[model samples]
Target: MFSKSKINDPVTGKETDAPRPSAPQAPASSGAPAPKGSDFKASAPKVKPPASTLSADLHVTGNMKTTGDIQVEGTVEGDIRAHLLTIGESATIKGEVIADDVVINGRIVGRVRGLKVRLTSTARVEGDIIHKTIAIESGAHFEGSVQRQDDPLNPGAKNPPSPKANPGS
Candidate 1:
């Protein structure tokens, strides 16, 4: 059975006793308010950008460069450059890593240069680290030199000369 039901217009705050039409009606004028729920339906959908990930069973032999974030759960034999880099516990890297933020929970056999570097408890690193700031957890294993630099991301920057010792002191 078909029956007509009175409905209230959200924009105009008026009640209409007319029967609802099966088809959508065009706007009468350009200044007319939109129908109820029309604003939500007309709005664009929100979407998030995807992050690059290397799976545990995969291996990469070439350099990787990205302006976005990267998560590595596999082995990499080449250099990596990104905005943010995360190394999983089961991952292994054999080359240089350059990023703004680098979190290592795996094994690294090459140099690491970043503005901020963190080595988790399970991390094992065998190469030098050049960073503006760095943190090593209690259980982390490191077998290389660690240097602090004012600009760790710039490889061509020269370090300031140390102060000379006085002979009469």
Candidate 2:
């Protein structure tokens, strides 16, 4: 009953069709049918998001966790877990750090755990480091023990079970 309606064109003062037919959509893939309302785009590549930055004057007292990258230029008193964590030259962290990649150019007093960890020449670390791979530049002040593991991100799991999700904000 509501299929046909005349829309007046304001510019030309002419009648126009109100209901327009939608364009036909091709299947997302050539082989298997994609689920309805699937918005995945194969051609549009996903880019790595920019790191969340904490300014030099800011101070955080609680835990921080994310699946994305984080760059700290301030002070954090609690533990941090991220995909990639970068400590700026002026940053100072008092708790443990866990990430896939950890780059420290500042000071950290707690344990560091990562798949890859790097300490720049200006970095100062006082806690032990557990990493699959680690690099320390010359003049880096580190007083901690270092241990290498094949899967440093997971501390004690021998056989691969379901991955543990880190709870965080």
Candidate 3:
């Protein structure tokens, strides 16, 4: 059943033919010569960075910061800053959450600041939300106000005057 390639049987001093697999050819549009059989492998597609995950049994008490995305299924007692943050259904966060995109499906007890914020049907939020765009699903429980801002991620932006203050008082 073997093909043309030959192998020497050391014990019998006989040559036997073996089937040889061919290398994969690269597309002509790649602009490169075909790789040798021993060195050829299929090109891999571009992959995004992996998201960091906090499992349901974990609990964190300090600030967390990352330029990449994060998926939290645990509890966190401090602030979080990331490019994208997903709070899982079992998660509970007690501090600020600042990200470019925030999807909350759990519980949060502090402020939320993001460019785009979404509270899923199972979400429970107890503090203010500052976002450029926000959506709260029908079954989400939010106990605080949501304020839109041009730059919700910037800490240096001026805060609105307190509603309780009277200009003459």
Over 4 Å off, model 1: 1-48, 161-169
Which is the winner by TM-score between candidate 2 and candidate 3? 2
Segments of candidate 3 deviating more than 4 angstroms: 1-46, 159-169
What is the TM-score of each predicted model, taking all chains together? Answer: 0.68, 0.69, 0.68
Residue 11 error, candidate 2, Å: 13
Model 3, position 156: C-alpha lDDT score: 68
Q: Candidate 1's residue-wise lDDT over 28-50, tens digit each?
A: 32236657766534334766467
Model 2 Cα lDDT, one tens digit per residue, 1-169: 1233233334444333333322112332533455679975545587988999999999999999999999999999999999999999999999999999999999999999999999999999999999989999999999989988777777683434435654451
Index of the highest-lDDT prediction: 3
Say which prediction, candidate 2 or candidate 3, comes out ahead on lDDT. 3
For model 3, the run of ten residues with the poorest summed lDDT: 16-25
